[model samples]
Target: MEIRWVEAFIAVAEELHFGRAATRLRLAQSPLSQTIRKLEKELGVRLFDRNTRSVALTPAGQAFLPHAHRVFEELELGRQSTRAAAGEVYGTVSIGFSGALNHLTLPPLTRAVRQRYPQVTLSLAVRVVTRDGIEQLEQGSLDIALVGLPIAPSSVRTRLIGREPLGAALPVDHPLSGESAVDLADLAEDGFITAPAESGSSLQESTLRACVKAGFQPRVVQEIADPYMILTLVSAGVGVALMPSNVAGIMPSASVFVPLRDEPTFMDHALAWRPDNPSPVLHAVLEVAEEVLPTPRT
Candidate 1:
C-alpha cells in the first residue's frame, strides 16, 4: 500500500535474498524482513518462499513485479511534469557546444529556450572537443551540452538531435574539387587537417579510424582547433578537411563539398544533461531541435 513497502518488496524480489536486499537498501535485515512480512500481510498473500538458506518469489510476487516497476516509472514521470508546469526556471544551466554545432543546431535551440524560459539564464561555454563537454558535465559546471557523439559519456542522459555524414571540403582550385564525391583512398597523398587528438574529441578519433578503414593514414598537414579555421585553411588551398554535412551551410564559400565514399560515416549530435540534475529548459530545447531537424542528412 505504501511506497516504502513497494520499494522493500521490489528490492527483496530483485535480490532474492532478504539479508542481501537489506544490505543493498541500507537497512537492517530484521526491519527489512518485517517490512516484507507487513507487505505480504497487507496483500493477504505470501509474496516470497523463504527458508534459512534460500529465498524465492511466490507466484503472486512474480505477477506483481511488472506492476511495481510501472508504478515507479509513472510516479517519476508525474513528478517531472509537475515540476515542469511550476516554471522551475531559476536554476543556472551551463551549456557547452562544439564549434560547428553553433551553425547547425544552436540557433533554433537558443530561440526556443529564450522564448519559453527567460528566467533560466544559460551560460554558454564553447569548446572544441567532446571530452571537454563530458568533463564539464561531470564536474557539475555544465548543465547541458550539444556534443558530437562517440565522445559523450555513457552515464550522461542524452537525446539525439541529428547526424551528418562526413564530407570533404577543398578549395575550388583543388584537383578533386570538380567531383561531387571522393573516395577516402584517393586523398591519401593530399594534405589533411582535422581537430587535434589532444582536444579529446571522439570526432578526431573517428576521422583517424575512417582513414585507417580506407587503408591509409591521413597525411597530417595541419591540426586546427576550430572548424572555421579548418574551412579557412581548405579555402586557402593549404589542405583538405573532413567536416559534417551541416557545416557546409555555415561555411558558404568557394569550397567544393563532397561526401566520402568508403567512410560514409556521420557524426551524431545530441543534447546531453546530467541524469541527476535535469535541466528545466531541456524539454523546450529538445522540442525546438526536433522541429528544426527531424532527420539527419542523407
Candidate 2:
C-alpha cells in the first residue's frame, strides 16, 4: 500500500536483478528483498520469480508496474496543486545518511519537511558510509549527507548537528559489562573491533584516539563497516568496541554498552553539502533541518 513498496516493485521489474536493483536504489540487497516481500504480502501476489540465476516479473508485476508509475504521477499532480496553493518550494532533495542519524534524527526531520513543503520529496539513502558520502556529495549525487565528523577534507560545507558520547561495547558475559560504567583504561587488555581504516571512518579514529588518551594503543582484531554487524561480532565475544552511546540498544541482549567513566570521548556529527550546488529545494530542506535539529554548540 505504501509508495515505497510500489517503487521497489518498479525497480525490480525494470532491473530484473535484486542485486542491481538494490544498487540502483542505494539499499542493501537483503532489505530490498524484504520490501518486495512486504509488497507481495500486501497485494497477495508474487511480483517476481527467480532461481539462483535470473529474475522475471510475474504477470501481476508486469500489470502493476504502469499503475505504479501512475500512482507517482497522480501524487505529483496532487503535490503540484498543493504547492501552488501554499507557494511551497517544489523539488526533490536526495540525501545520504548513515549510522545513529537513522535512529535519532531522520524521522522528525522528514516529518517536519513533509508538513512544511508538501511538494518537496526527501529521497533518503541508508547504509551510506562516511567515505562514500564524501565522494557522492562532491560528485553531486547527493544534495546533503548526515555523517560523522572529522572526515577527510573536501570543499563540501558542513554544520555541526550534534555531539555524541563514545562508550565501550562489550559482550554481556565480559567482566566489565556488569559495571554501571567502565573506565577506558580498564579495557586496555581486551582486543578491539573497529571500523575500516581506509574509509576515513570517524568511528575508527574515535576508537583509536579514545584508547590512546586512556594510555594504551588498542589491538584491533577486526575491521567492519556495518555497525550492526560490528555489534553482532561483539555479541559473539570477538572484542570490545568504542562506539557512539546512542548505538547501545542495537544488540543489547548479548552485548552490553558501558559508558566510558572518565572524561568520556565525544564524536561530532554534521550535515554536509557542496556550496556550489544550487538547489532551492535543498536549501529549503537545510533550513528546515536547522530549525528542527539546530546545531548543538559545544
Candidate 3:
C-alpha cells in the first residue's frame, strides 16, 4: 500500500532471496520477510512462492513488479518537476536591454548565462531604450534590464556596471576624422543626429549635457531611436552624433569614431530590476551578470 512497502516487495521480487534482498535494501532479513508478508496480506494475493531452499515470484508478483517500478519512476519525475518549478534548476528569465548595450554588455552577459546556467532559458527583449526597459521591469514584463543610469524610480534596484565615454560619430571623410580626438566645442556648428529626449534614453541626455558643457547647444538636425541608425546617418554626412565609445565596434563602415577632447564625460550604465520582484530565475541571471559584467566604482 505504501511506497516503502512496494519498494520492499520489488526488491524481494527482483532479488529472489530474502537475505540478498535485505542486503540490497540495507534492511535486516527478518524485516524484509515481514514487509513482504504484510504487502501480500494487504493485497490478499500471494506474491512470492517460498520455501527453505529457494524463493521465486508467483505470476501475481511478476505483474505487480512492473507497476511498482512505474510508481517509483513517476514519483522521481514528480520530484524533479517540483524542484524545477521551485526554481532549483530550470526556469525562464526575461531580460530587457537598450540598443546601446547590444555590442557592449549584452553579448558577454548572454554568453555567461548560456554557459553556466544551461537549464535556464534566457528571453531577451532587445533594442529597448533605458526608459522603456525600466517601464517593462516595473510592469513585470521584464525580469532584468541593462540600462544607462540616472534612473529616477525609487522602487527600482540598480547596480553600476561600468562607465563609457561618449565619442563623436562622424563621416569617414570629415576633416576632423583625422584627428586623434576632437573637442566638443569644435563640433558645435555641426548638426547632430541624436535620440529624442522623449525616448527616455540616458545616452541622449548625456550627449546633450556634454555639448552644453562644451559651451554650445549642439545643432539638432535629426532624431533617431536606434543607435545604429543614428550612426548610419552620421556616416552619410546628414549629421554628426555622440554615442558610447563601444558603439564604434558596430558602427557604419563609413563612420569614424573620435573621442572628445578636454571632456571628462561618461555615460554610466547599470542593471535594474524591481525591488519586490521574487523570481528565482532572475537571481540566477543576476549571478551570471555579476560574473560577466562586474560593477565598477563610480
Candidate 4:
C-alpha cells in the first residue's frame, strides 16, 4: 500500500481514536477514516473495529502496526543520510603544508575546522615545498596550501596567516651562537646553507635580501630543500642558515636558533588556493582560516 495509507493506519492504530489521530496528522476525520478503509480494502483485511463512541485495533491491525512503524523509521533515516551527504562541509579537504612553515598556522586552522565542521575530513600533505605546494593546488590535487610568502605566478589567492622574524641557525659550539641575536654583517664571512636558489624559495630570497641590505653578499656552500636537512648540516658545522623562528622546533640538538638583529627582516606565511576552484568544503576551510589567522591591518 502507499506510504500515506500506511501512515494513516499507524496513526489511527496508535491513537485508537479516529478524531484524535486525524488531529495528530493534521487531517480531517472523514479523509483519515477513508484512507484507513482504503488501506484495509487493499490488504483485504479489517484493520480496526469502531462504534459511534469508541475505536479499537482489530487483531490484523495490531499485527501490521510494528511493520508500519518500521517503514516510517527507515524513510526518516534515509532522509537524514541524504541531507548529510548533500551538506556543504561534508566532503574531504586535501591540505598541503610547506616544510616547517606548518608550525605557524596548520595546527590552529585544522583544529578550528574539526571543531566547527565535524563532517569534513582532513587529508594533509606535509613536507611539501612552497613552490610544489602551489603546483599541487593548481593541479587540483590539494584544496588548500600553507606556504611561505612571495608565491609566484599570481594566479593563486592567498591570505596572510603569520609573520615572524627570521632567525639564524648556527652550530651550538660556534662563537656566534653565544650572542643573544646575530647580525647579518657578522656572518658575512661565514658559509651559508640554504634551499635551492632555482626553486623560487621565499626563504632564500628573504635571506639574500637581508644580507644585501646589511652590506654584504653571503657565501653559499650548500643548497638543501628540507629544513631538517639544513638544520642537520648546521649542527655539523657545515654552514649557517637563515630560517623562520618557528623552525626552531625541528632544529637538531647540535644546532641553536638565534634571532636576527636586523629590522624588517621577517618571513611571511600565507594560505594559498586557486581562485577558480569550487569545492564547497574548501570554502568552509577558508572560513576557518580567516577565523584562526589574524586579520591584516589597514
Look at candidate 1 and tell me the lDDT of residue 170: 82
Point to the candidate with the largest lDDT.
Answer: 3
TM-score to native of every candidate shown: 0.65, 0.70, 0.70, 0.68
- What is candidate 3's lDDT per residue for 125-192, written digit by digit as tens? 87788899888888778888888879885678998888988889999988899899998899988999
lDDT of 1 by residue, 167-281 (tens): 8888888888888778988888898988887887756776787888889899889997777888888888888887878876766476777778774777788777677764445
For all candidates in order, the CA lDDT equals 0.77, 0.84, 0.85, 0.84
Model 1 CA deviation exceeding 4 Å by range: 1-85, 152-154, 252-254, 278-298
lDDT of 4 by residue, 162-210 (tens): 7878889999998989899887789999999988888767788888988
- The C-alpha stretches of model 2 lying farther than 4 A from their native spots are 1-86
Runs off by more than 4 Å, candidate 4? 1-88, 296-298
Ranking by TM-score: 3, 2, 4, 1
Per-candidate clash tally? 0, 0, 0, 0
Give the range where candidate 3 is weakest over 10 consecutive residues by summed lDDT: 73-82
TM-score of 3: 0.70
Q: Write the per-residue lDDT of candidate 2 for residues 1-298, one digit (tens) a residue.
A: 7888888888888999999999999999999999999999998999898779999988988888888988875686577556656766797888887755356777778999999988788898876777788899998789888888887778998888879899989998999899999899999999899888886677888888888899999998988887778888999999988888778766656889888887978988788899877566777788999998899979
| TM-score computed on alpha carbons, candidate 4 | 0.68
Winner by TM-score: 3
